[model samples]
Target chain A: MFYDNEMTLSFRAISSNEAFARVSVAAFALQLDPAVSEITEIKTAVSEAVTNSIIHAYDNGDGIVHIWCGCAGNKLYIEISDNGKGIENIETAMEPLFTTKPEQERSGLGFTIMQSFMNNIEVSSELGRGTKVTMEKSIGE
Target chain B: MSVGFKTLNNCLIVEIDGEIDHHFVDNVKKSIDSQAVQKGYSNIIFDFKNVDFMDSAGIGMIIGRYKFTKKNGGITSVACLSDNLKRIMMVSGLYRIIKIYNTVEEATKAV
Candidate 1:
């Protein structure tokens, strides 16, 4: 069987849009017939990525967060990006419990949760430019 | 999302309805914190029976509350977790600092 689908969404980098982004991605991935647990994991990962963009990239100022999703042959691909202040160091940022905003009560487990939930995750950024996170997960065997 | 609080014997049981994520966490945190302060309650029991989804933001909120409660010589506990929420809780290592109960009554009694 050959299965292929793709979608792109862009919205303001605001807190309210976090739920909208994750639910929309989960709905799109429903075509793969993912299990409930799998769907939950995907939604969690998406939420983390989008939250990062809103809090870190845009600094809760004013910007747009973009999401691109494509599924091919039981595999889901997601790319969340923001054109805001980017990470200074990708390596340190990916480390567990590493957050710049500890005063905000951040657990710094966003990247860790995404890494564990998805099969693969890659982050790329240019300081003072922007950041993009790409992740992949297989659904329903 | 709506949050209902029940205070029983100095323990505030927070009954959360709907999803817990970055979008609505601020409200939940504000509600619970203010209630805790106004009622002079220290310990908090989060009843997750009705919550369907949560993410890292939920983890942050819980940890924040836990820290605050701990400073006040109180405890933080969670009750009635679904499998998905359990997975997230375990992955985050929240079990180390927060107690888990099977039911709201158990959590309230523990406090």
Candidate 2:
């Protein structure tokens, strides 16, 4: 089924907006009538993706995070993108424990958590250009 | 998020309220660390009964505390985790290093 509904949000890449971003996405996802666990999982995935954009992509203290969410039938789709410093190596960034900012005490589990919660995830990036993460999940499965 | 601290049985009980995320993690960490130092308590038990959400930032904070307590010959444990939080904990392999209890009272007695 094609996505019948969608919403887009763009916010400053700030830590305070992390919770705001996830809550907004989760609210939009309520139309799917997802189970409590399913919604919680979606919220977590949103949080992780937003955190990566704010902390890693815009670590230089400036950038905007864009999120686009769409839903159709029982499936939800999400795309989070940032135009800050792009990832140098997408493969290394996706690894479970490979974090470039170890000094910040990052667990480097952001992508892992997103993958665990969503049905599938894809990442694309270009040096000095930007990074985009797309994730999909089927609810009530 | 709001954090409440108390010293029970020589264990620092850090009760966290509301969402645990990157936005509030630094403040939470500072509060817990300062309380532990002032009270001279090495063992710490996180009370998450009221936590609405958590992410990787919480995991990092927990691991950092685990190392701090372990180096001080103490232990770090969590109490009152929702099933959703437990799922994240499992994915992060945090259960390998710390223990979980049904209540802070049980953790205080054990730690």
Candidate 3:
């Protein structure tokens, strides 16, 4: 027998309200059986990515955040991509405790939390181009 | 998410509702620390009665608070954790450092 399942969702990266949509997607994809902890982790990670795009990428506060998810062979994959002011230095941004918005008290731990939650994280960004974050996690059945 | 704080025997009693995830960890930490400092409360009792979910970030935040309180010669306790949060706390090794109480009153009194 062969089993192949995939899911995808796309929405504007405009407001925090949209972040909640990703949680619903993850929850539904997991058949509502995911551990509460797992669900929370995925939601937070997605929120961080989307917020980064809204605040950093689309500094004008208007753009689209594309998200895609797929499940294959007991592994879940999530991709969040944004076309905006691309990152100049991905290395510095990923560092813990580094934030551009110091006045806002941003912890700059978004990428760190995402990496910690997911099994694998791959970031692709180009100055003046865009950013795409690919994350993968293994589901326990 | 629901957040409320009160004072008991000079200790701060923080009641958390809804999911305690990374999204709210920083806010919760900052709020509690600021309140404790402002109100001059050395000890803190976290009431998790209404919390339905938590993740590793939540554990990290709790451990961080424990250290903060410990350094000040104060203590921290947790109360009414849901079974899921309890298991996560156990796996994250939080139970080893922070004391757990059956009720908020007990935790407040112990501190």
Candidate 4:
């Protein structure tokens, strides 16, 4: 027997609400009994991904950020999708310490941090087609 | 997250309570550094006795402080890391640069 669990959330592209979304997701996924550090890592990875969508994908606050999560077997998958300015160079964007907005004090470590926390990260984007990031992590022993 | 600072024997003790993630990393870093510098403390002790959660941002904050304190010829030690956080810290290679102690007193004595 197999059980599939899924959750979804939509939020504005603002910084203050980013943390709220992250904590909410982690709390909902608590059934996995993730270690405290693992929980924090997952939340941080989600926060960075969502923040990137808001700050880079959208301009003039023009769209919504969609996040979805699912758990199957021992793996948890999270997807963040945005309909905004698409990435012209995904490779450049994923590079460490690379940011289009340096004046905002952006560390450019968002992608780097995301990669570090999760087991796997997949990104899909097209010029003006928006971007979608899917990340996965394992839970328990 | 809650942050408190105190000085003892020329060492600055910063006690962090709760999760340290992207949400709280900046403020924690700012608060600790400002208070430590203002108090004119050379050595520092980070009391993570109550911290059950931490992320890469937290790692960055700690590393940044170690660098800052090292530049002043000072030292930094972390005390009471929960098992999970200790594992993350180890994987991130933080233990190599910052000493880890079982108790705040031990950290204080070492620093």
RMSD of each: 1.6, 1.1, 4.9, 3.8
* Candidate closest to the true structure, highest TM-score: 2
TM-scores for every predicted model = 0.97, 0.98, 0.67, 0.77
B21-87: candidate 4 lDDT, tens digit per residue: 6557656787788887898887889889898766556676777788779988999889999887787
TM-score of chain B only, all predictions? 0.96, 0.96, 0.95, 0.95
What range of 10 consecutive residues in model 4 chain B has the weakest lDDT sum?
B19-28
Who wins the lDDT comparison? 1
Badly placed stretches (over 4 Å) of model 1 are: A1-3
Give the poorly placed runs of model 2, Cα more than 4 Å off. none
Can you write out model 2's per-residue Cα lDDT over B26-100, one digit (the tens) per residue?
667877888888899999999999996899999999998998899889999999999988988999999998898
Query: Against the true structure, whose DockQ is highest?
Result: 2
Docking class of 4: incorrect
Greater-lDDT candidate between 1 and 4: 1
Q: Which docking class does model 1 fall in?
A: high
**Complex DockQ per candidate:** 0.86, 0.89, 0.15, 0.18
Mark the regions of model 3 whose C-alpha exceeds 4 Å error after superposition: A1-3, A31-37, B20-45, B53-111
Please state the error at residue B62 of candidate 4 in Å: 1.3
Q: What share of the true interface contacts does candidate 1 keep?
A: 0.82
As a whole number from 0 to 100, the lDDT of residue A79 in candidate 2 is 96
User: On a 0 to 100 scale, what is the lDDT of residue A62 in model 4?
Assistant: 68
Q: Ten consecutive residues with minimal summed lDDT in candidate 3 chain B? A: B85-94
